[model samples]
Target: MSALFPALLTASNKQALRFDGRALTYAELAATAGSLAERIEGAGRVAVWATPTLETAVGVVAALLAGVPAVPLNPRTGERELAHILKDSTPTAILAAPTDQLPPALAELTRIEVVVAGAADPTPERTLPQTDPESPALIVYTSGTTGPPKGAVLPRRAIATTLDALADVWGWTADDVLVHALPLFHVHGLILGILGPLRRGGTVRHLGKFSVDGVTRELSSGATMLFGVPTMYHRIAESLDTDRELTKALAGARLLVSGSAALPVHDHRRITAATGRAVIERYGMTETLMNTSVRVDGDPRPGTVGVPLPGVELRLADDSDGIGEIQVRGPNLFSGYLNRPDATAAAFTEDGWFRTGDMASLDADGYVRIVGRKATDLIKSGGYKIGAGEIENALLDHPGVREAAVTGEPDADLGERVVAWVVPTDRQSPPSEEELANHVAAQLAPHKRPRTVHYLDTLPRNDMGKIMKRALKSA
Candidate 1:
């Protein structure tokens, strides 16, 4: 496969990006990237800190085009986090937003070249260097639940394979316009949300940050595709009944995709009922952009994440009752983690398959169902092992509940008791605790029912829309 920038440039001469209010065609985008590439020649690593705008996009591709490894930093992160990454990666240059405020340490990196992008500059023409498939092209930081965030090294071949698989499975084309609201610092938004669309000559409209009102406006502006996580979809679903414009705007979208975490089956049904569009939930992670998806043409089962994409293999470890630790081996899998040889070695089995920490089962029709996380998220109570996600899905089906998260709480006799944090659609009209408890008992086994339900106005969430269960536990 060709280099990403070159492949994107060759796709078409038509408009490639729509940001804020302006349109930049493929020719124009390539010219900007090439111009930036000339000024940053010889830089071994380039770090970029900017919002998800067209200029930031160009800076990233330009660094790669110039044969430099691109490191994307979250603008909202603290200076300490920034310094640690810089120290570890030792980037030779930095490309940042033209903001007045910057870390003092950033100023002290005298040996590093810094370029303030999004400023006025003259465009220059330059040729991009040839890139090897094995060469590292992007480094994404993943904040582990317990340790400091580690940079996951993704090679050119891995990214290309992911995009190719997405295009083939979804039938992406230039006619599609993807409305992306997720943060670009993460893999889901960067690879599946941005790269996939651009590689197919499809247009992407970047919403700088997520806002229910702002997203409603973009959807009204005629975006054909929408990608988001479960939390974002829940908020949109809540706003659908009162926001006529949002309802009409979302109705125009041809596809609505959700991932990054398990999407509650209740949210899926509610979003479809409110907007007249079915939500397609797929399974993927930071290590892999996408692996399986609910088919667009077939029955989109609410609980199942659907079949694996072509060229991808899925097998359960230990093969106990068709449910086990999920393992995947494919072209799209990451080469390895950066600087953590031991962790990288442990991530794969002897046969080269990557061991996904998720526990899941495969149905007879080839659909994949995520049972729960292999670690803390799965609870054991009264000698019966239970998947918190299963009970969470049942609680979400309750009409009075807006959101729910199930976790294990300490118990004297049961070993662990199932507890839930719930957010109601109307705080003033909250359901009785007995009502919700009974609701779960009707839908689930006695062992799966939540012993305690705590109601909150909102749930703690990370930038990627994952509920921070640790925070909930502390609360």
Candidate 2:
């Protein structure tokens, strides 16, 4: 319990990780990590900006093994964002490649030392340290939708607890080979994609970046499992017609996981039809690494996100409406938001449950269904509440529609009106506003039907595949 990496290293030995045509075993990974940890300053923060590669993974764990906090930065982040994070965290050094791709401001930070890993370690004087469960390990930044981005601090114990819960719920073993496609900056990719499999003596194949071609190639190369966002799945499904071998390769995958955003029912059916594999959708956020997941061996429901994982507790704040905000409490819960005491205090309830800000309900059988985000996606019109997810799901049923996002538009007549922004597969064959309204009218209640429908070639999305509802409201 004290040192999670050491336990993982002991448990996993001789496992192979396939990277760029080379296979590195767990023993090699451990040795490399131990060597790199000796070079970094002890008990300080290090900013990491690199693509998902074997070297990047080793650097992250090496920093943690030295009792240093690791902060993962998105490779596509701008200079402004990088400046803000550096100013806030004030890391002792930056563990990045010696490339001109870094922001100009980063180059000016002469006080901070920079170490280029992946090559021979010229400075071999540094040494690794033992880590306690309560020690802060990693800091993951959240998408600043409401305001400026804030880093969420996660402890070693929380990460270990999450991995243990995932392994128990999914029955993960050393035999499983996880194909990772998402960006490593996010927690989902870090824990589930990298650490989860590595902890179990299993192999993780890093695809570098998420591309239909890359994933298709990896799957053909004997990747057994895949973890991606819903949009990634949709893109692969859309590209299937161009590459029949991609479809066949995906069909050969043992498991497919969808998360970060809700999977459209239409895309779900398309994936199943093309690959004969039910895409298993899971629920998690930056504050909590993983809470619940759809059963892999049980009935794979299209809309529902399934039950809570082991050692996790989920409850509704107020059950008057049968749907209330989701509250969770578990060992995997994050420590708190970094440097924001008031915000952190407001995020949790008096009873120590973390308020998730997402509306959900548990069925009689204990399956959890995420209704919508409480703050943005729920629309109140004429004293009736409407879930945007329901209307979005119905719109996806139309063959002509490739993607759709539903939001509430300000209306003088009703308090708010249901409005849909749709991206059509064929621009010329886009469904008419009347046809789309009628389509929802047949499936949903009269009030839930979209009164105004607009067609767009593409919808603005965040890095995590969640639709930018704020952009839709302003539009």
Candidate 3:
């Protein structure tokens, strides 16, 4: 198989990456990562202290060059979760920037400082290690909503196939430059945002921390694309009415993509109305890197995740009322959960389709509208199945509603009752429960209206901006 980043193997001087104002050309990155690779070439696996920094990016690239699997450890992870990941992956060494204070759990591992300043080799002559397509390249851990986080072993082929498919669908080219402020631990930020640009020999500028001003500056200065999650897009939508520079910057960009969680229809309308740039959405999970995305040349359907990517098979299992659990099989899928053969076997069907616990309905044009998760988003009340996502969107349409999340509670009459958790735009003058319920009932069906409403200052969310519904249920 060829090198994952072919441009790195060359001596081109084009800028490949920029983080926190520090820029690196392809020639510099190749030499730096090559030098680092030689230090850990024989390791079985390495752990990268995944921070939004240049060193983290160089470290992961170095591990790939050495044909060693890299495990990205989230910096904000809880102590127990971090301990579990280290125990599970059993990495022989850990890589971090010199300035990072080592956590007690990672203190015992062999530490390697990734320094990018003086490692550049203008002319490099070392032969990069050849790795098989099926070899593991990354070990990304899931959010572990059910139990301890499970490591999803992604292979070189999965990464290559996904990026290539996205290039074809997005019309991505080497001339493009991407701007984003997404976290580096998740696949959305690391694989799609960072690695995707590298594979195309393009440039990526990371925002260190996401801010509307930072996004405006980069997009206004010739960035071709923007990748973000729903939370970030929500913030952008809120600022578009007040920030003229942001509106102009987004309008000038060639593409805007949202993922990790579904972007609300309300936010989609706000952004598109202000900037004339409809934000396209994609659907995938830890097990499957990417399955479906809205095409660049096709309709930017506001609420749907377009169709399946090239060379992927998708199906709906246990259909009812035109909605069912999504199942997929593709080269973009991870090899399996690391060291958990029984769990891995259970994740797949007898025919080899990976069972994604998300539920969605397919449109006539093969567009996928994700309702919610099969476990948390599906609600059954009065013998009618309802998706929390649609109701939440409807709630957001109200002028007084700022944020909303829906869940089901036990009901003596209706097997389960729809419950709403809301954050009002004006805390002192929040919308009444009856008024909000009526608003939702008018938009959707009467049966889908919330039976109980609870007010909150904010909804719980994870690093990727996904609403933590389980936390709401527990609360």
Candidate 4:
């Protein structure tokens, strides 16, 4: 197999990565990561303490260069969750910065301090070992909504195919400078945000932590792209009207992408109205690196995640009403759950398509609009298969709503009745249940109106800014 990053070998003095205030040229990165790779060459598997710092990036790149599968452990993970991951993966060694204080869970494993400045006065033309494309590159764990988090083994082929597909769609090239401040444990932040730029031989500037000032500083300088989750974009939208600098910075960006959760239609309109730049939405799971994206050349549809990516085949299961579970078949899909053969076999259909539990619909133009998860967002009220996303969108369009989430409850007559949880813009004068119900009924069918409304100060959200509907339902 060819080298994953050919540019690393044909090294130049060009800047490859910038994290916080430190910068690394391609030459320096090649030398540093290459030397680190030599130290951990034969490890069965390695764990990277995935901090949003330069050392974490170097450690991951080193693991890749050594052809060892890397398991990225989140720093803020709970002790129980961390224990589960370490026990499940059973990595031979754990990699971290010299200054990092590891937890008790990792005390039993071998420690490898990843020093960024190890290769001093290093030369170019560094060598990287080649590995089979189908070999595991990274073992990323899922959110563990149902049970213990499962590690998804992603292959080098999946990474290459997914990044190349994104490049084709986004017009990504060496000239592009990417900017982001996202966690390193997930696919959206690490693989797409970090490795995507490296594959293009482009520059990546990591902000360490996301802030409006940091985003403005990078984009205003020379960064051409900004990658963020819906929460980050929401903050940007809130500040755009007052911060002329932020509006100008966002307007100047060549691309603004959102994923990991749905960007509310209200936020989308506000950002676009403020900066004259629309945010592109993409859809994927940890099991699938990326499936669909609103292309750079395509229409910027607010609700849709555009069409299937290059070399990907997507289908909707049981599409009687044009809404169904999204199933996909592509090289970009993960190999399987690390140790759970039963779960691995169950993830895919006999025909080979990976059954994504999320639900969505297809537009006439082949655009994909995600509705909600099958377990939480699809409410069967009065024998009607209603999607909570449309109702949430309608509720958000009203002036009083700040944040909204929808779920269903058992009903004697309706089988399930739609229930709404909202964070009103004005808590003192929150929209009455009748007004909100009528507001949704006006935009959609009367049957879709919420049978009950619960007002909250704020919606429960995960780290990625996705509303925890299950939590809301339980509450």
Name the candidate that leads on lDDT.
3
User: Which window of 10 residues has the lowest lDDT sum in candidate 3?
Assistant: 117-126
Clashes of 1: 0
The Cα local distance difference test for each model comes to 0.77, 0.78, 0.92, 0.92
Instruction: Name the runs in model 2 displaced over 4 angstroms.
Output: 6-16, 41-43, 108-127, 241-243
Question: TM-scores, in order shown?
Answer: 0.92, 0.92, 0.98, 0.98
lDDT of 3 by residue, 408-437 (tens): 998999999999999999999999999998
Worst 10 residues of 2 by lDDT: 110-119
RMSD (CA, angstroms), candidate 2: 3.1
Superior candidate under lDDT, 3 versus 4: 3
- lDDT (Cα, tens digit) per residue for candidate 2, span 1-475: 1156543345234555555554556555655566657667474788776456665676676677677888887878877777777777777666664442566656644323233333333333333566778788898888776677888899988898988887776777777888867777888887778877777777888777688888888888867889999889889878877789889888998888899999999888888887788988889898987889877686778998888988899998775446778899999899998898888999999989999888777788888888688888777788776778878999999877888999887888899999999999799888898888888989887778889988898899977788988887787
Cα lDDT tens digits for candidate 4, 174-242: 999999999999999899998899889999999999999999999999999999998899899999889
| Model 4: lDDT of residue 120 | 40
Q: What clash pairs does model 4 have?
A: none
Candidate 4: deviation at residue 259, Å? 0.4
Off by over 4 Å in 1: 6-13, 110-125, 318-322
